[model samples]
Target: MLPADDREIDLKTLKFVQYYIELGLQAFDDWSNFNVVDQFQTASLRYQLYEIVYSLATYQAVYAPSLRGKVCEAMRNSIEKSLTPKVMGYWKWESLLGKWSLDWDPIKKDNIMVSGYMLKALALYTGNTGDMRYTEPDSLPFQVTKNAVYKHDIHSINKYVLRNWDDSNFCIFPCEPNWNYTACNVIAAAGSVGYDRVFNQRNFERRRERFLKHLKEDMCDESGTLLPIKSTFTGFTIPGILGPVGESVSAVDTAFIDVPTSARVWSVIKHENIELDPKSGNYKLKGLSGADFIDMGSYMPSTGAAFLSFAFLANEYGDYEISENLIKQADEVESPIEELPTGSLRNKGISVWVGGFGLRARLIRFRDWTNTVVNGPPKQCINGPVLDGYDFQNVLVAKAYSPNGEDLELVLYNGRSAGSFSLRLAQLAPNASYKVSNGASFVADQNGTGIISVKLDGRTEVFTEKVQKV
Candidate 1:
């Protein structure tokens, strides 16, 4: 088993995670209330769903490997929400102006914004949990209307994304009809890499060279700065004045598949957009205009959102000093967090979409994002003891995993009122005697399942290891 100190999670960070978990549990049914309003697409339902699933999946991969059910459900809900007419039917309007016909099927054409995120979520769910439910035929159904339904699943989505890449003259396709975005394509590329990782396929590998070549040549300017948008019909590329926002987002996405390019792009962003604040002795964003300051979610000026993005990128690249400094800058300007009944917290000033970025920045370790995408979760965590069917509302799980695929470790907090709760443990050695941290011992049944009781007043840590025979 790993040392106890290695698995320790502090109370503040625990609550931060609880916040996203609680949000994810409710994301399936009621995502509209989480600030799902935007002039652009940032704060839309689909985007919010993507952010929520992304946050929850990351948490599952790193901290709570036992929470696979919750993450999978959230991913399903996100795919369902993305297929809704209101969320994806915008393609109808875009198709009118473009060469394609009005097809309500969102993923069949050039909407990488919808398809990319959905692919990422599905890939993450399957990769982390090893669940193959999404791979079934017509598992993801898009109901355009009462009679018009489009059948799709994980395989179909992957095929469509690859096909779109193959068909596009730019090699990187568009999010809307003709508007190509570097950030969105990066998301799609990362999703493709994720899919390949899970299925042991080289779909992305075959197209990797051309994708990178076009991404660098067609989407970037003379200085190698990533441009935000390009028009396929006119072949017009937007300038990189919004480099801070675009580069930061792309840095996180690109790191999943291509670490070297990600590092190089991040170096440029740091040199151009970041500076040392001599007054506070912290790193802060520099050379931002009003356009750059606008939060993509709310379309309002928010220095905090910008800071959060930079912090997220910094964290992804293992720049802890820059990440911590930028997070402090965000906290200084962002609204105070409100505690929820379940011991979770939320910021009323920022949209939930933006808040998702904050959660990622806080929880993600250096290369955790890339590692999760490229390698999936650790194999030991997948095959080891799992805490299933725990009381999510009352017991806040901080860390729950098996370090060596044989032992169990958990750190939990009282989410609400202090009380005793029961946790179901699965995947143990069958009928084996085990020692518990709470001065107790139990033997697993023939089916390799057992229940352990935990009393949570504030924080509780538990460890269960098999009793080695002489």
Candidate 2:
């Protein structure tokens, strides 16, 4: 359970998370015209899916343990969409140029940019929920044509990633055929870390030292700054690619695999990119290029996305003052918000990719990225009582968890009109009596299920503890 001081989930944060849930539920079969930006792949469906999966998984693991169903659905959908021909069709062209043949199977080859996110989403869903559905053979089937289908599961996909790493002389595999982005490679390595955690293996640990050594020695410049892209074929770093935008994003991704190094990199980025305002005394972003201001999704210049990414990095590394300041700045400058019916808040000025980052910035606590990656959802959370079947439109679930295996605590808000809403409780002790904070008592059925009605005017806090008979 969260500490008493940390129990309250603000309405803004709740709305942000709800935004992700609503977006995740929608079908992603086609996104060619959604927010197409051909130059930077950040606006692509693959990247959007990655951001959504990451945000939802983090929210479930850290805040709402009972949201496993929705989180799992979102993750599964993202994984399924990622393996589709539409989402991964670029691999055919890249493979033809690099390998002299067409390969529609994105996961089998060196497209870590796509494979890494898929693997991480799988590991997150399985590890956090203790669900093994993805572990079955041929669980993820990619249909390339009427007669061709590429089959893979969690284990096989991870094996491909590890094999790529092992075969790479640079110790860091490529996102494209010959181009390796430090950020993408870090995400791939983080996926491997999640895989080891899920299967209780030391595959990543065995290669940790070597990977870090090469990452630092071969990929970084003399000033210890992480270069953005390195050529896998020629082992040469790309000139002029290293910038504040790349460094900030890479620092956040690196936290999942290497915490100390991420912190050091963030220190440099914070110094270079952030500055203090004399009048407001709040830290603000500086020294950013026009490209940094451009929203990767819509190809339109929007400072909100850049501010959100910077704030996300600051929040990930325990720099709360800077994070808060950056967010405040973003809100002041880019303040157009759209309130959805699902109790979600969306910034109308930013792209979906930037919106996802906004949710991440709001939900993440200090060092949350590393903690959630290394040690997944707590055991008590996995085996504990879960709240379900609540009215999502009317009831905003801020915090829902069982401190032990027998108690439930929740913080909820009225999404629209304040009224009484019914909620179902699962995994309770069968036929046992429980006490609710509202002075109501109930007994669970033989299957350990019960329903409780909560009345809400604004914000309500509720807890249920099992009764111990003398």
Candidate 3:
């Protein structure tokens, strides 16, 4: 372990690191055995397992031991076999029959490359060393970036166009059929699977720079406004950030909405060096493929997504592009939390929060921090984003992330129950009446920040910590 006097972090760092290691182990076993596809060839399980493997490789390289070879190999085989190289990539939802059945969707195909930012390290670990090092387990995802999205010197897909619709700049950028954070996974996985040999550090940095430049030059307005999916006027030739609450919500309306300017704000902030007027909030406001920021309002979840996204970047990259206040506010954010609402069990290290209900809610926190959700919370915390359609399951998992992007607090409650439930505060104001959306009462104690004794809908339980300041 790093010394207690280590200047960079605290025991929390150790805990966080160990937690990730454990999480990786859990995911490894889960993915190795869990069916990749379902009866209808649907992807019952997500691909964050690749992320876990990548992180594990990283942790082992600097802090712990590398994973076993057999496990790594299995992971590698599954991912490589599953991928179908194209202009960019094709999305084939897998099934859960303990087999390689695939549900392929070639349509709506764009070149989005999403992955947890850890892939490069993993690939290097497993790849050519003087001798075969256990650093990379076969579980690493890509054999080569060429195998990832790049083919030789040509980029089959434009990273910018993955989520945007652009047509004019067709040569370098692709349309929104596939590019986005999801696609980042492809790049990250390839890098992790292959390491610096293929996705060289210099090359990876180049990709990030290129992606940013494209978003600024092709997708964003000089006036600082971002489109929803793509510049509406340009179609799929160019790609950039568009406004949004949900992908299902039309980009046109999202840009014009009233609550979540966060998506737009983040786009502006990420490329903050844009030659525009931050104060005027006007420049080439409309010439963006010839439209107007006429639809400037607010987006709730988009704001949340953007803020959380910024925080994620902050946590990962330490690039302070946004406001200090904004970062600090994010650092102090609380879970729209509930103590366990039905069960009497006092679960430690869990707290929950919600931004929206049903399909629109996002669980912001997960063991793999970059394991984000575009629509619903992972079942690890929330129950039934599962589409079962049965109404009466009142209590499920409630998870939330602190603004600091450091603490993950979760809770349990019945969406259907009314009587008060019990729980301990894991992430909240201790010995203090904290503010929650539901205005529920909580008993606070100190676990990490402040553990709470909770009562919601008549059931009861205990939690171990509260929101933390970064």
Residue lDDT tens for model 3, 143-221: 2223332221112122222222233242123222222332232243234223334323334333444444454454435
- Of candidate 1, the 10-residue stretch with the lowest lDDT total is 1-10
- Flag the better candidate by lDDT, 1 or 3: 1
RMSD of 3: 16.8
List model 2 lDDT by residue over 309-385, tens digit each.
88888888778888887887777666466777655787777877777777778878787766667787777767777
- How does candidate 1 fare on TM-score? 0.92
TM-score between candidate 3 and the true structure: 0.35
**lDDT string, candidate 1, 68-98, tens digits:** 4454566567667666666655556566666
What is the clash count of model 3? Answer: 98
What global local distance difference test value does model 2 have?
0.76
At residue 166, candidate 1 shows an lDDT of: 96
Off by over 4 Å in 2: 1-5, 28-34, 37-40, 145-147, 468-470
